[model samples]
Target chain A: MKKYLYIIKTTFNDSIQYISSLFIRFIGFAITMSILLSLWTFIYQDNTTISGYTLKEMFWYLLLTETITFGSKSPVATNEVKNCIKSGNIAYQINKPYHYIIYSITKYFADTLIRFIAFTIISTILGLIYVGPINNISIISFISCIPVFLLAVLITGMIKILISLTSFWVEDSQPFQMIYSKIILIFGIFFPIEMFPKIIGNILRYTPIYSVSYGPAKLMLSYNFSFFLNILITQIITIIIISIIINIVYRRGVRKLNVNGG
Target chain B: MLTEVKNNLKIMFLSLKYNLIRVMENRVSFLTSVSMMIFNNASFIIQWLTIFTLVEYIGSYTLNDIMLFWAISSGSYGLANILFNGANKIPEYIENGKLDAYLVMPKNVLCHVITSSTEPSAWGDLIYGYIALIIFNFSIKNIFLYSLLIIIGALIYTSFVIICNSFTFYFIRFSETSEILKDIFINGSIYPDVIFNRAIKIIFFTLIPCALASWVPVHLIIEFNIYHFILLILATNILIIIAFFLFYQGLKRYTSSNLMEARS
Candidate 1:
C-alpha cells in the first residue's frame, strides 16, 4: 500500500510535467461543449423539458458526461496496455516483485485524478458560463456525484484494460476501445439515456455506458437513494466481472508467452 | 506543366498502391482496423438519430441532411488522409528531426512529405461515405456531384490541415495548438450546419474551413447552384495557394535537428 501510494505521487508528478496537453484537450472539450450547447439551444427554442431535463440540467449533464469521456484516462490505459503487451514489457513487469495490476491501476488512478480535477474545474467554469447553474439539485445531489464519478473513472479504465488485454489473441485490439468509447459517448455522454428512444435507452441502461457516464451525471443532477444504490451495485458487479476476465486473459497470455518476451 | 503534374500523380498512386500492399501484409489487422473505423463513424449517426427522434428539423437539417453532412465530412476527410496522412505527422517529424529524410529527396518537399504515407482507417470512412450517400440521396447525378465535391472537399481539408501544421516550423508551441486546431476543424464538420449561426459559420469558413469541406459541398450536392459552385472553387484554390505559401515560407525558417533518421 505504501509502495502504491508512492507510485501515485510519482505518477501525479509526471502528469503535471505535460500540462500543455491538458490545456489542448480542454480546448477540444470546450469546442464540443459549445457545439452541443448550440444544438441543444436550437432544439429547445421553445420547449423547456423534453425528456425530464431542462436546458440547464441538460448542459450540466453533458458537462459531467464529457468529463467522464475526457477525464477518465481510458485512452491512455488502452495505449499503455497495448504497447506493454506489444513490446513484451509485460513479461518483465509480471515477473517483478510488484503486482502489475495494482501498479497499472494505481498509475491510471493517479493520472486520471489530475486530469479529472483539471477537467472538472474547466467544465465547471464552462458550465457556469453557459448555464447559470444546474437546477433541481440539493446538497445530496452534489455529494452523490463524487462516488459515481470515481466509479465511472474506474469502470472506464477497467473496460479499456480488458479490451487492450485482448492483444494476446487478436491481431489488433486498439479499435475495440474506440468502439466502447463511442458507445459511451453516443448513449450517455453527449445526451442522457433518457433523451434516447425508449427501447434503446432501456437497453442501454444495462450496459457499462450507463454505469460509466450516465450514472454520475444523473446522480449529480438529481440524487435518489435507490438510483444511487442501483448504479453502485452495477459498478461493483462490473468491476468484479471485468477483473475476473482480466485475470483469465493475463494468465492465458502468460502461458502463451511462456513467461518469455514476445 | 501538365507533364509534371501527371508524373507527380503517377508517383502518388504508385506510393499508395505499395502502402496498401504493406498494410495488407497483416490481413487480420487490416480487416479489424477497417471494420472498427466504420463502426466508429457509424456511432455518431446514432447520436444524431436520437436527436432527429426528438426534433423534426434542426435548422432545416432533416435526417437526410445530417446524413449528407456525414457522407461528405467522412468522405472528404478520408480522401485527404488517404493521400496525405503524413500531414498528421508533421509535428512529430519536426520535433524528432525525421523531416531530414524528406528534405533530401528530389521531390517537392510538401508533396513528398504528405504523400509519403497512407492512413489505413480512412478506407473505412470512404466506404461509409458511399454507403451513406446511397442510402440517403441516391441518384446518378448526385453520385457524380458527390464524387466531385468529395475531391474538392478533400483538397480544402488537406490545405486547412497543412496551414495549421505549418506553424510548427516556426515555433514548437504550435505543435499542440495545431493538433487542437485540427481536432476542432474535424469535429466541427460532424454536426449540422444549421445549428451554427452566421458568426460561427463565418469562423468555420474563414478560420477552420470546415464549412468549405462539408456544409458547402453537401449543399451543392443537394441543390446545384452555379454561384456557390464558383465560389467554392475560388475559395478552394485560394486556400490551397495560401497553404502552399505558408508551408514554403515556414520551411525557409526550419532549422534541422541534425539527428539522423530513416524511413523504413
Candidate 2:
C-alpha cells in the first residue's frame, strides 16, 4: 500500500510538468462539446422536449458524458504493459517488491485523477458559460456520485490493462484499444442507454462498459437511490471479474514468456 | 514544371505501393485497424439519427443532407490521410530533424515527405465514404463529381495541416498546438455549416479553411454551381501555394538535430 502511494505521488508530480499539453487537450474537448451543443441546439430549434430531455438537460447530459469519456482515459497502463511485454521489462518488474498489476493500477489511477480533475473543472466552467447550471442536480446526488465515478475509473484502468496484456501474443494492441474505445464512445458516452432502442439499451446494461461510462454520469444527471445502488453493485462485480481475468492472463503470459526464454 | 509534376506523381505512387505492402505484412492488424475505423465512423450516424428522430430537419438539412455531409467529410479525410499522412507528423519531423532524409532526396521535399507514409485505416474511411455516397446518390455523374470533389477536399485538407504544422519551425515545442488546430478543423468539418455563426463561418473559411475540406464540397455536389466550383479550385490552389512557401521559408531556419536514426 505504501509503495502504491509512492507510485501515485510520483506519477502525480510527473503529470504536472505536462500541464500545458493537458490544457491543449482540454481545449480540444471544449471544442468538441461546443460542437455538440450547437448541434443539439439546432435540433431543438423547433420543439421543447425530445424523449423527456429538455435542450438544457441534453446539453448537461452531454457535458457529463464527455467528462467521463475524456477524464477516465488510462493510456499509461496500456503503454506500460505493452512496453513491458515488448521489451521483456516484465521480467525485471517481476522481481520488484510490489505486484506488477498493482503498480500499473496505481500509476494509471494517479494519472487519470490528475486528468479527470483538470477536465472536470474545465468542462464545468464551459458548461456554466455555455448552458448555465443544470439546476436539477442535488448536492447529495453529486456527493454520492464521487465513489461511483472512482470505481468507473478503476474499471476502465483494469480493462485497459487486460487489453494491453494481449500484447504478449498479438503484435499490436492498438486495434483492440480503438474498438473498445469506440464501443464506449457510441453506446455509453454519446447517449444514455435509456435513449437507445429498448432492447439494445437493456443488452448494453449487462455489459461492463455501461458501468464504466454511463453509470456515474447517469447518477449525476438524475439520481435515484435504487439506481445508484444497482450501478454500484454492477461496478463492483465488473471490477472483480476483470481483476480475476487480468490475474489469469498475466500469470499465463508470464509462463509463456518463461517458455520463450524472454 | 510539368516534368517535375510527373516525377512527383510517379514517386508518390511508388511510395504508396510500398507503404501498402509494409502494412499488409501484418494482415490481422491492418484489417482490424480498417474495420475499426469504419465501425467508429458509423457510430456518428446514430447520433444524427437520434437528432433527426426528434426533429425532421435542422436548419434546412434533412437526414439525407446530413448523410451527405458525413460522406464528403469522411471521404475527404480518407483521401488526405491515405496519400499525405506525413502532414500530421510534420511537427515531430521538424522537432527531431527527421526532414534530413527528404532534403537529401531528389524529389520535391514536401511531396516526398507527405507521401512517405500511409495510414491503412484511412482506407476504411474511403470505403465508408463511398458507401454513404452510394446510399445517397449512385448515379454515374455523381460518381465522377465525387471523385473530383474528394481531390479538391484532400488538397485543402493536406495544405491546412501543412500550414498548421509549419508553425513548428517558427516556435519551439508547438506540436500540441498544431494538434489542437487540426482537431478543431476536423471536428468542425463533421457538422452542418448552418450550426456556425457568421464569425465562426468566416474563421472556418479563412483561418482554418475547414469549409473547403468538406462543407463547400458537399454544397457543390448537392447543387452544382460552376461559380462555387471555380472558386473552390482557386482557393485550394492558393492555399497549397501558401503552404509550400511557408514550409520553405521555415526550412531555412531548421537546424539538424545531428542524431543518427535509420528509416525502415
Candidate 3:
C-alpha cells in the first residue's frame, strides 16, 4: 500500500504543472453545465414533478450526474498510443522498466485526480453560491463510499485501455474510442442508468459501467446499502473478467506491434 | 488572382481526395467515427424534436423555424468541422515540432496542415442536417435560392474559422480563445438571431459572423428576403478575402522558434 501510494503521488506530482489549463476548461465546463441544467430547471417549472421527483430533486439529479460524469476521466489510452505511433516513440517506452498498462494507469490516475479537484472546486463553489448542497447522505456512507468510487474509476480506465488496445488490430481506433466515450457520456451523463427505459436500464444497472457511474453516484447522493453491496460484488467479478480480456489483448497486441519500423 | 483561386480550388480538391483515400484505408475506424457522428447529431435532432413536441416554439420561432435554424447551423458546423479541425491542432503541432514536416512540403503549408487531419465524421453531421432540412415544413419553392445561400453561409463560416486559426501567429497560446469561439458558435448561433436584441444580433452578424453561418441565411431562405441573401453573399466574399490575406500575413510571422515553441 505504501509503495502504491508513493507511485500515485509521484504520478500526481508530474501532472500537477498542467493543472492550470484544466482550471480554465473547468470554468467553461461549469458555465455550460450550469446553463444547460438551468434550462432543464426552467422547462420543469410548469410541471409539479417528473418521474416522481420534484424540480429540486431533478436539479440535484442533473448536478450530481454532471459531477460524477465529469469525474470520469477522458479515455486517453488510444490517444497515447496514436501519439506514440505517429512519432515512432513507443520503442523508448517498451524499454522502460514499468509495464505499459501500469504507466497508463498511473497517467490516468494523475489525470483523474486533476479532474476530481477541478470538478470538486467548481461544484463546491457553485453549490455554495448558486445552488445549495445536493443531498444529505450520512457521513459514514460518504466516507465508506469513496473507495468504491475509486474502484469504479479504475474499471473505467481499464475499459479505456482495452478499447485502445483494439487499435493494434484495427486500422483506426479513434472512432471506436469516440463511440465508446459517447456511450459512457450519454448513459452516464445527465441521468442515472435507472432513469433510462426500464428493461435496458435494468440490464445496464448490472453491467460494469453502471457500477462505475451510477453505483458510486447513488451511494454519494443517496445511501442505498443493498445496492452498494450488489455493485461491489459485481465490480469485483467484472474486474476479473475485464482483466483476463485485457491480458489476452495485450499479448496479441505486443505480438502484432510493428516495433522494427515504427 | 483568378488563377490563384483556381489553383487553390484544385489543390483543395486534390488534398480532399488524398485525405478521403487515407481515411478509407482505415475502414473500421472511419466507419465507426462516421457512425458516432451520425448518432451524436441524431441525438440532438431527437432532443429538438422532443422539445418541439412539448412546446410550440422557443421564443417567437415555430417548430419548423427552429428545425430550419438547426439544419443550417448543424450543416455549417459540419463544414467547419472538416475544414478547421486540423488547424485547431496547431498548438499541438507547433509544440511538438510536427509542423517541420509540413513546412518542407511543396504545396501551401497551411493547406497541407489543414488537409492532413480531415474528420470524415463530419459528413454524417452534414447528412443528418440536410435530411432534417428536407423533412421540415419549409416550402420547396425556393430550393435553388436556399441552396445557394447555404453554400455561401458555409463559405463564410469556413473563412471565419480559418481566420480564428490564423491567430496562432500572434496569440500563440489560444486555448481560452478557441474555447470562447466554440462557445460563441455553439450557444449563439443555434437559436435565431431575432431572439437576441438588435445590438447583439448586429454584433453576432458582423463581429462573430455566426449569423451568416446560420441565422441570416435561414431567415432569408424562409422569408424570401432577396436583400439579406445578397448581403450574405457579399459578406461571404469579403470574409473569404480577408481570411486569405490574414492567413498569408500570419504565415509570414510563423518563425522557426515560434513553430518550435508556440502552443497556438
Clashing pairs in 2: none
- Candidate 3 chain B: 10-residue stretch with minimal lDDT: B255-264
Which model scores highest in TM-score?
Answer: 1
What's the best-to-worst order under DockQ?
1, 2, 3
Task: Please state every model's RMSD to the true fold in angstroms.
Answer: 2.0, 2.1, 5.2
- The iRMS of the candidates, in order, is 1.2, 1.5, 3.8
Model 1 CA deviation exceeding 4 Å by range: A74-76, A136-140, A259-262
* DockQ category of candidate 3: incorrect
TM-score of chain B of each: 0.96, 0.97, 0.84
TM-scores for every candidate against the unseen true structure: 0.95, 0.94, 0.76
Say which prediction, candidate 1 or candidate 3, comes out ahead on TM-score: 1
By summed lDDT, the worst window of 10 consecutive residues in model 1 chain A runs over A253-262
lDDT of 2 by residue, A1-262 (tens): 8889999999999988877778778878888888888888877787697777777877877887777668877678677789888888888898899999989999999988988888889988998999888767788888899899888888888898999999888878877888788778778876777778789888998998678877877777778999999999999999889999999999998888852462
Poorest 10 consecutive residues by lDDT, candidate 2 chain B: B49-58
- Which whole-number lDDT from 0 to 100 does residue A189 have in model 1? 81
Best lDDT among the predictions, by candidate number: 2
lDDT of 2 by residue, B142-162 (tens): 779988998888899999989
How well does candidate 2 match the true structure in TM-score terms? Answer: 0.94
